[model samples]
Target chain A: MPVSVKNSQVVYDALKELGVGLISALPETWLVHLIRMADDDPDMILVRLAKEEEGVGVSMGAHLAGVKSAMLMQNHGFLASINGIVSGAQLFRIPLLMLISHRGHMGEADPWQTEGGMLTEHVLEALRIPFDHLDHPDTARHKIGEAQTLAHASDRPTALLLCRDLMWEAA
Target chain B: MRRLEALEAIYPRLSDCVVVTIMGAVAAELQSLGHRPGFFYLQHAMGLASSMGLGIALSRPDVPVVVLDGDGSLLMNLGGLTTMARYRPPNLTHLVFDNESLLSVGGFPTATSTGSDLAGVAAAAGIPYSVRVHELPTLTAEFDAALDADELRSIVAKTEAHYEPPAATSGFVTDLGLLENRFQFQRHLASL
Candidate 1:
């Protein structure tokens, strides 16, 4: 199934409304539209990351410069970025707004993504990062806004899981 | 050139630049000289200083962002080099102080000791200007040019593997805590 362009626009519009001037991301199946949206927007700065961990540092720098920024990646990418999240963002008290595509969930078709999908919530809990499920267009904007607010207020990492319900459309 | 001497020579030139230094000796030595609002000692997260500098440079194209990185840290996230090249922010200057050893954690040898060329890697990664310098004069000159020109540049300075013990720092712990440093830096950025 292809990702829903309508849902992608909802998320992208929400980020822009939230004043996110910069975003760092690694390409993922569910994030194709969002990455393209950011790339095509002249006002937005899209940093194509070599690795997800680099996004953590990018967010930190953005905060230091008073720029609102977000990081977009998949579950496995989030897993790869834990070290930077813990030591760089957490230790230094930088606000990180991460929009992670929740891959390998119940309807997952890929075997490789399953392990990371299963571990995603557990690791997020262990890291004490507050997160919300962006599973519906009705509440996604509110959740993302709240997450961004919490991240800046607490000066720590916050995540919004992009569930399949929000990203995918039935064929 | 030694790391401290290189830093000392360049410290005065950094008044207008936002400098991000990797943890341990580089951070300690820079802090020892003095703490400026534009200076950020990125501690604990080893290899991300370059990434941070790239972000800052992209965010604020008005000022130059200099990353004072080390060989070990640079090796840990060499992919950052590729990413930086991809963006190629004109306001960013990456300075890798290649001392050949991990002097912070018991003097372990890094790949640079065995001849891995960081500048070569950066050049191949597509940075417009990348060079390796083994002398203070050349390092300073390249740094000046990088700052003055509106182009993405990177300089890897070969230095002796030397460590400055904590005792030598005399109990200095960056007067401001981590959060305080961020707030101060943001304010400084606003002023600029």
Candidate 2:
């Protein structure tokens, strides 16, 4: 199924407004549209990563280089990256803005994704990383900007969870 | 080749370059040689030095960024090689000292000891330049060439396993912590 063009536009606008210069993305079925949008943006450098943990490291490195960067992945990828998130980014106090597609949000029909969905907020809580849920495209720009501001000010990783309802165009 | 000797050969040549060292012997040895604000000694993050160096290189294209990684560390994050190659930052140089053992922990042999080729892996991953050096002079030449070239390069140097206790008061464990070191490094970069 093709991702909604409108949702991709909103996310891209938000990323641009946050001054994200580089985006490291791991494969996620739901995020294909956003990744494609990032690749098309002239001002942004989109890097395809082999693993989600690599994105955390790349984002940290980008932060040190004085470039604003983001990591795009799904809930499972976020789980795979916990070690890097804790040991590298958190320990170093490097700010990273993460865009995560919330796969298992309430009412999600995919049984395989429910475990990751249920544990997503818990994991972030354990890491003490604050996150916002994006339930509407209209709020994406403001939410993303706020998330980036918080991440930079706190010098810690922050996240925006993109719910399926928000990503899928209204029926 | 000894890791210290490999470091010594290239230490004097490093100027205004950001160096990220993998934790353990490499970090300790680099610290014993000389502590510079430009150097970031990563502790506890076993396989992240190369990735961090890649980040630094991508962000600061004008600054030369070098990663001193170990065989075990490189093996832990082989995916980092492909990621680094994909970006192909001209100012980045990745050097892995293959002692074939986890020297920091008890000397357990790594995959390299049984015959893993990191330079070959880097070349396969699409890095422009990759070489394996067994002699000090060749290692020195490789370092010099990597610094002089505006292309991504990787060097895997065979090193002897030697255990040297790290200083009790090294920069990594000081009260300053990683956060303080990051700020100091950033301030230094800003000055340059």
Candidate 3:
């Protein structure tokens, strides 16, 4: 069974329920659905970043502006953005719930995605940031809510890593 | 040459100016000169001083902002110059100190002077005002003049590619999170 649009919609509904004020997304294959959902929502503030790193900077700046924002970027952007996360986003305690569409993981056809997938855990650890994978419906809603809550309550950023398997299984 | 003169000369005229020195010895030197804590060290982040400075300039256009950029550091985000030009921030000075060598990170050449003229590149990018300096006295005069100018400016100071950098760590905090906060902190920057 191919991952259906419903899965992305399920995640979207959960985020809307969590009160996502702003979302920064790159219109990648898997992320496009969520981007559309976020766009259709009038209350959501969405801004396109020139680069992945700039998105981190914008998120930090917007956080300064007192807006709760999340980043929706391609996994490849993770490479360009890791520095901003470690150097900036994490250090500032600007919490953002990452609605990532996992790329380059085990079944990734592109060679480049493979490298990022292999290093995802190691990279997140290096920054001292905590994250949980969302591949099943049983905990997806709870995990999404908790991540957003943790981002707000603790003032520490949390990541919600979405794997290719989950996207396929549920979508 | 022009950069040191700009630092010394501009401080007297622009009362609301802020400076962000790049990593290595320059940070220690700026610290001794009695500057505020910005994201000054590499551990906090690398090659973001200019970007951070730009954010400040945009937010506080009334106050002057200067980035004490090294040739090597400036090159890493040369594309930023385009954004700088597009934005055209007033009261912002990008003082590029070009020693032609990466003095702090071993004696490797910066390659700043290798292929293109950085000042010219800035001019072409619509910086509105651009100048280069090498001699101390003339550079100082130019610095004073540019600070008083009515438009955005970019200055490239060509110095000895081999001056010994300071060894002490700067008092400046390297926390990007703290610096990006909305509230004003005197500890981070004094009105002086």
Error of 3 at B65 (Å): 3.4
Q: Write the per-residue lDDT of candidate 1 for residues B65-169, one digit (tens) a residue.
A: 999999999998999999999999999989999988988777889988898999999999999999999999999999999898899999999999875644446
| DockQ for all models | 0.83, 0.73, 0.16
lDDT of 1 by residue, A85-147 (tens): 998999988899999999999899999889899999999999999999999999999999999
Q: How does each model score on TM-score?
A: 0.97, 0.95, 0.67
Which residue runs does candidate 1 get wrong by more than 4 Å?
B165-176
Model 2: per-residue lDDT, tens digit, B57-141?
8888888899999999989889989999988999999989999999877899998888888889999999999999999999999
Writing each residue's lDDT as its tens digit, candidate 2 over A1-171 gives: 655778878888878877889999987777888888888877787888888888887887788778899899999999999989998888888898998989887878789999899999999999999999988888888999999999999999999998877786644
Clashing pairs in 2: none
Ranking by TM-score: 1, 2, 3
lDDT of 1 at B172: 33
* Runs of candidate 2 exceeding 4 Å displacement: B166-176
Q: Highest DockQ, which number?
A: 1
- Candidate 1, residue B188: how far the Cα is off, in Å: 1.0
DockQ, candidate no. 2: 0.73
Best by TM-score: 1
Error of 2 at B42 (Å): 1.6
Pick by TM-score: 2 or 3, better one: 2
